[model samples]
Target: MLDKLSLVVTAPEIVLLVMACVIALVDLGVKSRLRGLTYWLTLGTLAVVAFAAADMAMDGRTFYAFGRMVVSDPMGNWLKCFAAIAMMITLVYGRPYAADREMLRGGEMFTLALFALLGMFVMISASNFLVIYLGLELMTLSSYALVALRRDNEVATEAAMKYFVLGAMASGFLLYGMSMLYGATGSLDIDEVFAAIGSGRINHQVLVFGLVFIVAGLGFKLGAAPFHMWIPDVYHGAPTAITLMIGSAPELAAFAIAIRLLVEGMIPLAIDWQQMLMVLSVASLLVGNLAAIAQSNLKRMLAYSTIAQMGFVVLGLSAGVVNGTTANAQFAYSASMFYIVTYVLTTLGAFGIILLLAREGFESDEIADLAGLNQRSPLYAGIMAVCMFSLAGVPPLVGFYAKLLVLQALVASGQALYIGLAIFAVIASLIGAFYYLRVVKVMYFDSPITATTVSAPADVRAVLSLNGALVLILGILPGGLMALCAEAVVRTLAT
Candidate 1:
C-alpha cells in the first residue's frame, strides 16, 4: 500500500499545502473589510515556503514518494524556490493594481496562485507520466480561471476561452502520447520507459509517434512556433497581475517539464528528438523574433519575446542531446536554466513597470505611452531602461551571458551549424532590440503626448528596483549563479 502521508519530505511543499488549505478555509468562512489581508497572507506563505526551500537546498537530499511518482532533487528544489519567490514578487507588484481597480477582495486569485504553485512543485518533481499529467492539469486549470478573474472584461473572457480551448487540446495531445508510450513499453514511469527503450523492447515507430505528440504538447506550453498562436492575445488581454504569473511561473514549470521529458524519458532516442527540437527551435526563433518586430503593444511584444527565449532554450537542449556528450549537454542545460532565470527577472520587471503606469480606465500597454518617461520620473525610467537592456541581451547584462553560455556549449559540442544559427539568433536579438530601445528612446527622448504621472506603491517600487538591480548584479557576477546552475544540471543528469 502506498503511504499518502509519506509524500512530503521537504518542509516547503508541506508548508505550502498547509497554507493552501488554511487559506481556502479562511476564504470560505471569513469576510473582512481588510481587502489586502488575503494578499498579505499569500505573500507570507510563499515567503516562508521559499525560505524552507532554501533551507532544504542547503541540506541537499533527494526524496522519492508514492513508488517514485514524485522525486525531488536539487533541480526541482531550486526551481520550486524560484517559483515561490516569483509568486511573492507578483503579489507585491500586483496588490496596488488590484486595489486601484477595486478587484482586490476576492480570495480566488491568491488561492488559485497558491494552488498553481503547488501544482508547479509537483510538476517539477514528477518522475512518472501520471504525476506529470496531474500536475500539468492542476496548473493549467488554475491559470485558466485566473485569466478570467476579471469576468466583466470582454478581452479577459475571450483570452480565457482561447487559453482553455488551446490548453485542453495540448493536454489531449500529451495524454495520447502517454498512452502510445504505454502501449509500446507497458509502463507509465519515465525511468521504466527509458529502460525499455535502452533495452530494445520498445517499438521504434510507436516511440516516435509518442515523442511527436509529446513535443507538440510541450511546445504549446512553451509557446514555441506553430503552437504559439495564443500567446500575444493572452498576454495582452489578461490582467497584468495574472499576466505576470503566467509569463514567469508557467514558463519555468514548462522548462522543468521539458527537462524531465526530454532529458530523462527520451534519452535513449535523443538523436530523433534532437532533430525535431532543432526544427522547432529554428522556427520559433524566426517566427517569434520577426513577429515581435511589428508589435506596438508592449505586452504582445513580450509575448513574442517569450517565444524567442523558448527557442534559445530549445537550441541548448537540442545541441546537448544530439551531440551525446553529458558534460557539454549539462553545460547547455545550465545555460538554458540560467537564461530562463534571467528572462523571468527581466519579464517581471518590465511588466511591473507596465502595471505601475496602468490606471483604472487606462492601460499603458502601448509603446508610445512611455514617451518622455524620463522627464516624468527618472528613477522609474532608469529602471525600465535596465529591464529593456537586459531583455535585449546587451553586454554586461545577464541576458548576454545567458546567450553566450548557450553558444559556448554548442561550440564545445562541435555543432558548427547550430553555432551559426545561434549567431543568427544573436542578430535577431539585435533586431528585437530595436523595439526595446524604442521604448527607451520614447522614455528619454520623445515628449509625452499628455501629462504623464507615475503612481506605484512603495512595495512595488522596492520590488521593481530590487528586480532591476539584481539583473545587473547577476550579470556582473554571474559566476556564482552559473556554478549553481552547473550543479543543478549535474544532479539532473545523474538522476
Candidate 2:
C-alpha cells in the first residue's frame, strides 16, 4: 500500500533502509581489517538522513501517509533527527572498540544500528497502534542482536538472553493492552482512540485496566523501577560500546512512543495514567539512586542512573494536569521532551569517555577504572566531569536546566500532591548526586591504577571534543534547544 507520495513523508527512513542494505552488501567484498569503509559509509548515510530530518522539522508540516497510519510532524522529525545524530555518535565511538575486540568482522553493527534508527523513525511517525508496535519490535530486535554481537563472550550471551526474555514480556504486555484498547474503542488509530475515549461513552473499567498494562510496559521499556530488573545485568554484561549504543539513541525512540501512546492516543485517560506514572516515578527514583550507590561497576551504576533520569521524565509527564485543567499540557510535555533530549546528550558524552578508556583486553566498567583520569588527560576528564556534573543537576549545565524545567512545570500545576512530587524529586536528585560526584572524585583525586596515556583515534577525540562542547554550550545557552522543544510540542499537540 506504499506509494511514491508515501516516500515524501518517510523519505529519511526509506533512504536509511536502502543505505543500510547497501552498506551490508558492500561489506561482503571488503577485507576484515578494512571494515572502516563500512563504518564511514554508515556515518555518511546517517548524516544525510539526519539533515533530512532537520529539514522536515524546520518545515513543521504535518503530513499523514500510508492511509494515516503514520504522520510526519515537527516533533517526530526533531526526535528522528536527534536519534540519527545520536546513533552517528554511537557508531563513531563504538567502531574502534568493536575493531579492537574483533567484533567488527562484518558491517553488522552499522547495519543493525541503521535499521534501529529506521525503527525509531517509524515509531516517531506512527499514528496507529499496530504501526508503533511494529516499529518497536524492529528496534528491539536489532538491539537484541547488537547486544549479543560479541558472540564468543559469555557475559554478552547471558545479557542478550536476559534482555530477550524481559523485552518479549514487555512487548506482550504492551500488545495485550493495545488489544484491550482496540476492543474498548473499536479503532486502532491513535486519534480515533482519543476521540472515542473523549466522548466518555466507552467502557471505563476496560480502558483503565488497559492503561495499567500500558504503563507497566512503558516502565519496563524506559527502565523504570520494579520493571528495571534487566538493565543492570544487561548494561554490565554487554560490551561497553554496545551499552553506549543502547543507552543513547534508543531513549529518544522510547520518548517518542510514550508521547504517541500516552499524550496522543489516551489524553482522555490522563487522570488514571498520571497516577500510575506517579507511583512508577517515585519507585524508580528511590530504587535507582539508592541501588546505584552500592554498585562499583560503572555500567550498572549508569544503568540505575538511567532509571532515575527516566523517573524525572515521567514525573514531568504526570504533572501535565492538575484538577483536569489541561492548561499545563504544552509546558509539561515540552519539559519532558527537553529532559529526554538533554539526558541523551549527556549520556553520549558519559559513555563516550568510558569507550575512550577502554583498551585491548580491558573493559572500563569499574568506577576505579577512571582513577587519575584527570591527571592523565584533563581534556577527557573535563568532558566526563561535565557529563557527571550535568547528570547530578549541577548549575550552569544542561541537565540542571532540564531538571529545573520539570520541577517548575510540576510546581506550576499548583496541586499539593504534584508540588510534593517536586520536593521528592529534589530530594532524590540530592541523594543521587553522591554517586555522580563520586565518579568525578575518582577521576580527579584517586591515584592512577595504570599510568598508560589515555589515547584514542583522531576522529574519536575530535568528535568527542565537539560532543562535550555542545553539552556545555547548550547548558550556557539552553534557550534555543528549549524553544525548539517547546515549538515542536506545541505544533504536535495543536494538530
Candidate 3:
C-alpha cells in the first residue's frame, strides 16, 4: 500500500536495493578481469546510502512511514550510516583476500553483501515485529551464502549448514514469541503492543512467557553464551573475508533491534527481561573469556572475545531501568550504543589486519602466524596491538571508556546486585586481558613463523590507520560521540 511519498523514509534502503539488483545484472556482462567494476559499483552504492543516512541524521529528521511500519530517526539513521560504512570498509579490506582465495569468481559476494546491508537497513528502521524478522532472515540468508562462497571447501560448507540450522531454530523461537505476543495483545506493531501493555494494570503472565522466548532468540543473534555455539565455528570455518562481513556490521543492526523490541516495545516488562539479560551477560563473560584462553586460532579466539564484548553491551542494557524508573534508561542504552559502535570500529581494524596478512594456502588464522609481525611491519603490528589493547579494555582506548560508562550506569543505579555485577565484570575483564596481551607479546617478542614481508593495498592501509586513530582519538575525547549517542537515545526513547 506504500506509494512513493508514503515510503520516503526508506529512500536509503530503496537505493541500496536497486543498486544491488543493478550490480547483479551488470555482473553477468562483465568478465572476471573486469569484476572490479562490481566492487567499485558496490562501494559507490554504500557511499551514497551512508551519505544519505548521515545527512538525514544531521538534519534530525524523524519519520514514521508506510503506515508506521518503519521509522526514520537519528538513532536508526546513524546506525544505518555506520553499517554502510562498515560494509564499505569490509569490502575494501576483503577484496584482495577474496580474490586470492578465488571467492570472487563471480559478483555474488558484492551483491549478497549489498543485500545483507539492505537487511540491516530494514532491521534498523523497522517498527513492526514482522518487518524485523524479515530483515533478520534476509541478513542471515545472505551471510549463509557468503560463508559458503568457497563451495568446494568442506569446512565452509559444514559451517554454512550449522549456521543455517541454528539460525532457523532461533528464527522459529523469535516467531513463536511474536505469535504469543500477538495473541495476548492482538497487534504486530511494536508501538501498538506497547500501548496495549500500558493500558493494562500490572504483569501479564502470557507476555512474560513470550518474553523468555524472545530473549532467547535475541541472545542467539547477539552471540551471547548458551546460545553462542554458532559463532566460533562460523568465524573459524568461513573465509576470513566472509567472517569480517558477518561479524562487524550486523552487530550494529542487532543492537538496533534490541532497542526497538526491548526498550521501545517492552519497557513495561523490563524487570523480567533484565533478569534474563543478566544471566546471559554473566554466562557470556565467563564462557567467552575462559573459552578464548584455550584457542590457538586467532579468529576463534576473537569469536569468543566477541561473546564477552557483547556481554558488556548486554550488561549496559540490563542497567537501563532501575527501581521502576526510566530515568537512567537513556544513559544506559546510550552507553551501550557507544560501546557497540566503538567495538565495531575496533573490530574492523583487527579483522582487516588478519585479512591483509592472509595469503593463498595460508589462513594466517593461528596466533603464532603473527609472530615477529613487529619486525616485519611495525605499522601493522602497532595497529594489531592497539586493537588487542582496546579489546582488553586498556585505558586511553575507547573500549575502556565504553566499559567505564556502562559500569557507571550500573553504579548510579545504587543497586547492590548491579554493583556486584560491575565488580564481576571487572574481574572477568582482568582474566580476559591475558590472552589479548599474549597476542601483543607474540607480535613484539616472538620470532616470525615466516620472514615474508607484510603488505596491503594502499587504501586498506590508509583506512586501517584512520580506524586506529579514531579509536584512540575517541578515547582521548569521548565527548562528541558520547553526546551524540545520548541525544539520539533521548530523542528516540522520548518519542
Candidate 4:
C-alpha cells in the first residue's frame, strides 16, 4: 500500500484517474444522445479536481513522490487548476456542437476528455524523463482519437492521420533526446541531470546535439515555426470543437514540460538553449504573421496566430537567462506563463463563438460567414470582437498586457540583441494585427449573409459572456494574476 504522504501528494491524480474510469463506465449506461449524465459527472469531477489543485497551490508545500518521479508544487498545482478550468470551459462550449453533428454517438467525448485532463495532470507533475514521455503519449493519443471521433467524416480522419504522424515523429525526437541526456548524465531524474551537466565532465558536443533535438520537439508541441506544419491542417480539418480541445489546455502542459526540461534540468547550458530559442522565436514570428495574412479560413488564420503568440512566449523564455545570470528568471518565466494563460483564455472565447455559430448542418468556419455578424446577434458579435481585439493586443484588453509583459521581460535583460528582438516582435505584432482586425471588419462592416439571429444554450451563453468579461477585466486589473504567476514561479525555483 502507498504511504499517506504519497497519497496526499498525489490526491488530484488519484481522483482524476478514478473518476475518469468511473465516468467511462457510467457513460455506458447513459441513454441520452447528449450524454447529459456523463457530462454533469465529468464537470463535477473537473470542479473537484480544480478546487483540490488550487488548494494545494495555496498550501505552498512541495513534495516528491513515487521515488521522486513526480512532484507536487505550487507551479504545477496552479497549472493543473488552470488546465482543469480550461477543459471545463472547452466542454461547455463544445458539447452542443458535438451533439449536433452526431459525434456524441458513442459517448466517448466526455471520457476521452477526462482521460486527456488526467494526462495533463501527469505532465504538470512529472519530475522524471520517462514520466514526461508517458504523460505526453497519453494526452496525444486521446487527442488523436478525439480528432477522429466523427468516423464518417473524411476531413476529421485525415486530420487525425496528420496529427498522429507528426506527433509520433516529434515524440521520437523527444525520446531520443532524453536518451542522449541520460547516456551523458547517467540518470533520468531531472535534478540529477542538472547536477550531472553542471559538473562539467560530460561531452559538450553530445549535450548540445541532444539539446537541439529537445528544443525541436518542444517547438513542435508549442507549434513554433518550421515544425508547425501540422497545426494549420489539423486545426482546419478537425471538427471545430475538437480543434479547441486539442489547441487550448494542452498548451499549458507543454509549457510545464519546457520549464522542467530546459530551465530546471538544462540551466547549466542556458547560453546554448537560449540561442536556439531565439532563432526559433524569430522564425516563428516571421512565418506565422506573414502566412496568417494570406489565409482566408478563420481556423487556419488562428492556427498561424497561435504560432506567432508562441514566438512571444519563447522570446520571454529566452530572456530568462542572460550572461550566465538568472536574475530575471522569475520575471521572465512568469511573463511567459501569464502570456500563455491569457492566450488560452482568449482562444477559448474566439473558438466558442465559432462553435456557437455552427448550426445543425452549417460549418460557419469562413471569414465570410461572419459578415455582418453584428447585425445578426450583437451579443455574440460583441464577444467575438472582444476576442479579436484581445488577440490583436488592443489596449484595455488582456492581450495587450500579455504582449507588454513579454516585451518587458526581454528589455529587462538589458542586452542589445534582446532589445532588438523586442523591436522585431513589435513589428511582427503590428503585421499580425491586420488579420485579427479583418475579422472585426467582416463582422461589423460587411453585409449580412443571413438574417437569422445566432443563438446558443444558456450555459454556453453565460460562460461566453463571463469569458469575454474576464479578458477585459483582467486587462484593466492585471496585478492579481501577475502576482500569482510570479509567486508560483518563485516558489518552484526555490524548491
Candidate 5:
C-alpha cells in the first residue's frame, strides 16, 4: 500500500489537501467579512508547498509513495514549484479585484483554486493514465466553477457553458485515446506503454490513432489554432480574477501534460506525432497573430496571444527527429518547457496589470480604455509597457529569449523549413506588436481623457510592480531558469 506519511514525496500534495479542507471548514464557520482569511490561507498553503517542492528538488529522488504512484523527480518538482508560485501570484493579483467588487468572501473560489493546485501536483507526477485523467478532471471541474463564480453576470454564465461543453468533449477524446492505447499495449502504466512501443509489440495503427486523439484533446486545452474558438469569448466573459487563474495555471498544466504524454509516454513514436504538431504549430501561429490584431478588448488580445505562444511551444516539440539508435529530441523538449514558463509569466503579468487598473464599475478590458494612461499614472503605464514589449518578443526581454531558444532548437534539429516558418512568425510577431504597442503608445504618448487619478489598492499595485519587474529581470538573467527547465526536460527524457 502507498504510505500516506512520507513527507519528502507527498509534502506538497498533503499540505495543499489539508489546507484546502481547513479553508473550506473555516470558511463555513467564519463570518462573511472574514472570507478573505481563506484567500490568505490558500496563499500560505501554496507557499509551504512550493518550499517543500524546492526541498525535494534538492534531495533529488525520482519515485516515492510505495512506487505505486507519485514521483518527486526534478521534473515534477520543478513544474509543481512553478505552478505553486504562479498560483500564489495569481491570488495576490486577484484579492483586490474580488474585494473591490464585494466578491472577496467567495471561499469556494479560494478552495477551488487550491483544488486546482492539487490537480497540478498530481498532473506533474502522474505515472499512469488513471492518475493523469484524475488530475485533469479535478483541474477542469474546479475551473468550470471558477469561471461561473459571478453568477449574476450573463457573460460569465455563457462562457462557463461553453467551457463546460468543450471541456467535457475534450475529456471524452482523452478517454477514448487512453482506451485505444490500453488495448494495443495491454497496460495503463506509462512505462509499460513506452516499453511496448519501444519493443514494437504495439500495433502501429492503434498507436497512431490513439495519439492523434490525445493530441487533439490536449490541443483544445492549450488553445492551439483550429481548437481555439472558445478562448477569446471565455476570456472576455470571465471575471478578471478568474481569467488570471485560467490564463496562468491551466496553461502550465497543459504544458505539463504535453511533456508527459509526448516526451515520456510516446517518445518511440516521434516521427508520427512531430509532423502533426508542426502543422498545428504553423496554423496556430498564423491564426493567433492575425486574429489578435483585430481585437479591441485587452483580455481577448491576450487570449489570442496565448494561442500564439502555444504555437511556439508546439514548434519546439515538432522539431524532434529520430536517429538510428536514439531520438534527437532533447533540445526541442527543453525549449518548449522554457517557452511555457516564460509565456506563463508574461501572460500573468499582463493580466495582473489589467486586474490592477480595473475599477469597481470599469473592467479595464478595452484597449481604448487605456488612452492617456501615462498622464494618469506613469508608473502603471511603464509597467504595462514592459509587459507589452515582453509579449512582443522584443530584445532584452524574456519573451525574446524564449522565441530565440525555440527557433534555435528547430534549426539545430536540422528543420530548416521550420526555421523559415519561424522567421515568418517573427514578421507576424511584428504585426502583432502593432496592437500591443498601440496600447503602450496610448499610455506613453497620448493625452489623458480625464483628470482623475487611477488608483489601485496597495496589494494590487505591489504585485503588479513585482510581476512587471520579474519579467524584465528574468529577461536579463534567463540563464538560471532556462537551466532549470533544461534539467527538468533532461531528467524526464532520461527515464
Candidate 6:
C-alpha cells in the first residue's frame, strides 16, 4: 500500500502523466500543421515538471516511495530536470521539421515524446527491478512508435521493426538476469539484493552468470559496441527529428539505471563487472571510432560516434571501485555523470542543425550536404563547427573537459590496467577527431550546393543559439556543473 507521501515524492511524474493525457485529447482538435496548441501545452507541462524536479533536487533529500520500488533523491531529481529540459528543446527544434514532413499530422510525436520522457523519469527513480523494466519498456516502446511515425516511408518502418526486434531481445536478457538474481537472493529490491550478495552466502557462480547477461543488456541500451547493430540503422532511417529525440536525453536515464543496478545494487561484485565494463569500453572505442571514419552519412556517422562516446562513459564507471574499496566511488561516478550530461548537450546542438537543414523534399543527411555551409549561413556553420570541435575533444569546449574528467578518473585509480585503458581511449579519440574535423573542413572549404541562407523558426533559432552557447560556456566554466554532479552523486551514495 502507498500513502500520500509516496505520491508527493512522484509529484512531477504525476503532473507529467496527467498533462500528457490531456494534451493527447486536446490535440484531437488541433488543425494546425505544427500542432501549435499541443506544442505550447507540452512545453508548459515540461517546464513546470523540470522546475519542480530542480526544486526537489535542491532540497537534497532522499525518499523511498511505493514500498521502496522507487526513490526520490538529488541525483534522480536532477536527471529528471535535465531530461525534461532536453525534451522541451527537442520539441522546439523538431516542430518545424515535423511540419515540413507531415509527421505532425496527428500530434502523436509530441504526445509520444512526453510519454517517453515520463518513462525516463520512472527509470531514474526506480529502486526495484520490475520498476526499472517497466520504465525501460515504456520509453523504448514510445521510441519505436516515433521511429515509425512516418508510416509511408519504408525506411522508417524498417528501422522501427529492427529496433523493436532487437530492443525486445535485449529486454529479455535483462529480465532473465533479474530472475536469476531474484532466485539466488530471494528478493527483488535492489538494496536487499545488495545485502544478500554482500553476505557472501549466495551462489557466486549464479551471480556471475546473471551479471554477464545484465551487462550485455545494458550494453545494448547504451549503444556500446558488439551490441550496437541497431543504432546506425535506426538513426539513419528515422526522421531527423526523431533521431535527435532518440539520441539525446534517454542517455541520461540509461546512465542513471546503470549506476543504480551496477554500482548501488552490486558493488560487492565490482571486480567482476569492472572487468566486463573495461572490455566493453575497449571494443566500443575501437569499433565506434573505426566505423565512424568510413561513414559518409552524417546520421550513421554520429550513431557510431555515440558508441565511442559511451565508451568514455563506461570507462568512468569501471574505475569507480578500486581493490574493493569505495574511496574513489563518488569522484569516478560523478565524472561519468558529467560526461553524459555534456554529451547530451552537444548532441542536441549537432542534431538541431541537421533538423534545420532538412527541407520538405530534401533529407540533407549526408556529409556532403554540409559542404559550403559557411558560405550560406555562418551562424549555423559556426554552431555546427563548435559542436564538431567539441565532439572531437578540441580545447575550450565542453567535450574536452568531459573527456579530461573521465581520463582523470581512470588515472586516479593508479592501476596499470586502467592507465592502459585510458591510453587506448585517447588513441581512439584521436582517430575519431579525423572524421569530425573532416566535417568542419567540408563546411568551410567545400563548394556550396546552395547559396540560399538557412532559415528556421524563431523559436528554433533562439533555442539552437542557446544550446550552442551553453556548450562553449560550460567548457570555459565547467566547475559549477562538475560540482553539481559531485554533490548529487555524494547525496545518492549516502542513502
lDDT of 4 at 460: 93
- What is each predicted model's overall lDDT from 0 to 1? 0.84, 0.92, 0.92, 0.94, 0.82, 0.94
How many pairs in model 5 have backbone atoms within 3 A of each other, for residues 3 or more apart or on separate chains, i.e. clashes?
A: 0
The sequence of per-residue lDDT tens digits that candidate 4 reaches over residues 1-495 is 468888998899899899988988888888897889999999999999999999999999899998889999999999999999999999999999999999887668988998888898899999999999999999999999999999999999999999999999999999999999999999999999999999999999999999999999999999998899999999999999999999999999999999999999999999999999999999999999999999999999999999999999999999999888999899999999999999999999999999999863699999999999999899999999999999999999999999999999989989999999999999999999999999999999999988888878899999999999999999999999999999999999988
Q: In model 2, which regions exceed 4 Å deviation?
A: 1-4, 32-34
Q: Report the lDDT tens digits of candidate 5 across residue range 197-270.
A: 99996679989999999989888988998888889989999999899898887777788878778767887898
Model 1 lDDT per residue over 203-271, tens place: 799899999999999899988898999899899999988999899988888999999988888787888
For model 1, which pairs clash?
none
Q: Could you estimate the TM-score for every candidate?
A: 0.96, 0.99, 0.98, 0.99, 0.96, 0.99
Give the per-residue lDDT of model 6 (tens digit) for 1-495.
679979999999999899989999999999988899999999999999999999999999999999999999999999999999999999999998889888989989989999999999999999999999999999999999999999999999999999999999999999999999999999999999999999999999999999999999999999988899999999999999999999999999999999999988999999999999999999999999999999999999999999999999999999999988898899899999999999999999999999999963598999999999999999999999999999999999999999999999999999899899989999999999999999999999999998888998899999999999999999999999999999999999999
Q: Which stretches of model 5 miss by more than 4 angstroms?
A: 4-7, 32-34, 64-67, 322-328
lDDT of 2: 0.92
In model 4, pairs of residues that clash are: none
Superposed Cα deviation of residue 227, candidate 1 (Å): 0.9
Q: How well does model 1 score by local distance difference test? A: 0.84
Residue pairs clashing in model 2 are: none
